[model samples]
Target: MYCFMSTIDPGPPPQLIQLILSYLKDGQSTTEFDLRVMPLAQDGSTRRYFRVYSTNKDSFIAVDAHKTGGDPKTLSAPNQNQTFHYLACHLLERGFPVPRILQHSSDFNFYLLCDLGEVTLCSKVLENGHKNKKSTLELYQKALDLLFKLQTEALINFEHSWCYAGSVYDRNLILENELNYFLKAFVKGYLKLTVSPKSESRLQAEFQSLADEALLAPGDFFLYRDFQSKNLMLKDKMLYLIDFQGARSGPFYYDLASLLNDPYTQLLQTQREQLLSYYYKQLCNRYPKSAPDNDTFTFFFHLYSLVRTLQTLGAFAFLTRQGRKHFQSYMAPALENFHHYLARLSSSLKLDTLVELSHRLYEQNLNVKKRSP
Candidate 1:
């Protein structure tokens, strides 16, 4: 279980409770299952989770993510439920290890899903406490194999319209959501640093240049925006994906960067290089005509790794500011990652200000550590 998680009060709402019970009733002989709702630990999302038990059946995961507990049509934004349900069914049909959606309400707010085991890949890696244990490396290899399928086979017959915001992951998104997020959230919010107007203009120019490099990455593949260890659940020796509603169309290297540079496991450079070579070999075997050459792919890998690290720092800073201090601890590793990738691509990207800021972040982290004990 996550140390950060605690039981939230009052449990799920009334409508969600009734929906879960009714679904269980229809299948069971006595139609009696668990009505005692137990709250489960939540991720970085706004959704509420609960576990419903049963004597005959294994168990079920109950989700309550309603915008409001009112009429179904009252939802105004692009519904997360619709996207999750569609993606879950789509991936399941394609032999992906996603949870099966057992039932849902008319609004699609509440849902009952098969309980995937409680162990996340993050838990397994942390427990090992070694960066490159054979077991841990094996698990990552399996994850990469699954990732290959997700980018290749899953793209066939895939409809982008069913996705939430849109299909494409464009330069504008990079500028606003990611690069700009680093500028606003991390540089300003977390570090409490101010940027001069002239320096800010220079930063925007650098951001655009980085965005252009990002667009040059190889392949037309499905990008699992948050494909980190925490989002991967291990069950019965297989890894399953979760929290993938942010899936979009982008270059394959972005997700690779997310995985290899993930702060949770803090994989060593040697491990990362070995895995990169392994995945590249897989790509060559499958898409020989389309796969990028080693030098080109390596360049984009470093570029995208830098881009992904900046975005992660922004997210970590924002989450920490919101009172999630656990996220703050992760920032240390992420900043270390920022330094690593930035140093590699130091010549290619003109991020002098960001480079200095990263140094400050590191120093601040060290200061905090010293002040602690």
Candidate 2:
């Protein structure tokens, strides 16, 4: 979980260090500062981060992300550094709570951002042992309120180029890329199962249907592709959003699904419903005439939840395959959520092969857990 990557070939790269120091000094000479740099815990991304400390106790997060050839399948932007910087400034102007981008390399391969501290919503939930339902509900309500703002208010006259996935969250992005990512990463790689040609056909059809249903949801709002607790930072008891480079104009229900069904938080079914109802009320209050009816919203919620579940499982499987111990910890819970959503849709969605494979994987996971000791 703690990964330290040297910023330079030898010691801390002097140029990068000086760049950060100059920014801290407000474009003045960098010679007057004493600085300390330490690696922070790594997340699911390949980007390397360091917490830079100053003698005056000022701190900033330094990110080093090398440029790479683009992959269409990735949820991250092809140029995440630039995308993050642009979006941060854009959202800040709109009164959204996001880290400030202090400075950046001309190419945007590296940057310094306001340090938001170490406590994440996910960590806070775990710290509570997920037992304090009342407190947890309050936290989620706060998150939901922030999400509403992100999806609505900040989106006024939004520019599409600020998003990594362009302006729109289209059906191809949902079905072909995200669903197929699940097929490749979780089904084939992790589960180690081969689907017959007929089953593969059926799976594709089911995924397509889900995407079509999601696309019909009633709003062209901003969708934070990863709106879960882990990407949410809490500093001074105020929620700050991060890792939003993948945001795009999409159905609002997708974000709602992402938050409520997040495996990291593992909110109980009743709790999930309460939060969903709360979000619906807020949505209606905000856009009374435009907000979809409860039945329509519920339909897209399930559809998007299923897609989000698959996407999470795929990421977990891919990360685990790459030997990332941090993501490995989430695999069991993700599988449980996978089963939970699949079961809920069994009567409505025709995904027999995927269902069977998921059940098999669940049993296999349970057996592994039993034998772990």
Best lDDT goes to which candidate? 1
Off by over 4 Å in 1: 1-8, 31-34, 67-77, 362-373
Collision count of model 2: 0
What would the per-residue lDDT of candidate 2 be over residues 47-143, giving only the tens digit for each residue?
Answer: 7678888755478898776542233345354466667777888899998999988887776767788899999998898788767988889999999
Q: How accurate locally, in lDDT, is each candidate?
A: 0.79, 0.78
Give a tens-digit lDDT track for model 1, residues 284-320. Answer: 9998897888988888888888888889988877877
TM-score of 1: 0.91
* lDDT (C-alpha) at residue 91 in model 1: 87
**lDDT over C-alpha atoms for residue 240 of model 2:** 98
Error of 1 at 204 (Å): 0.6
- Candidate 2's C-alpha runs over 4 A off are 1-15, 25-30, 68-78, 363-373
Worst 10 residues of 2 by lDDT: 364-373
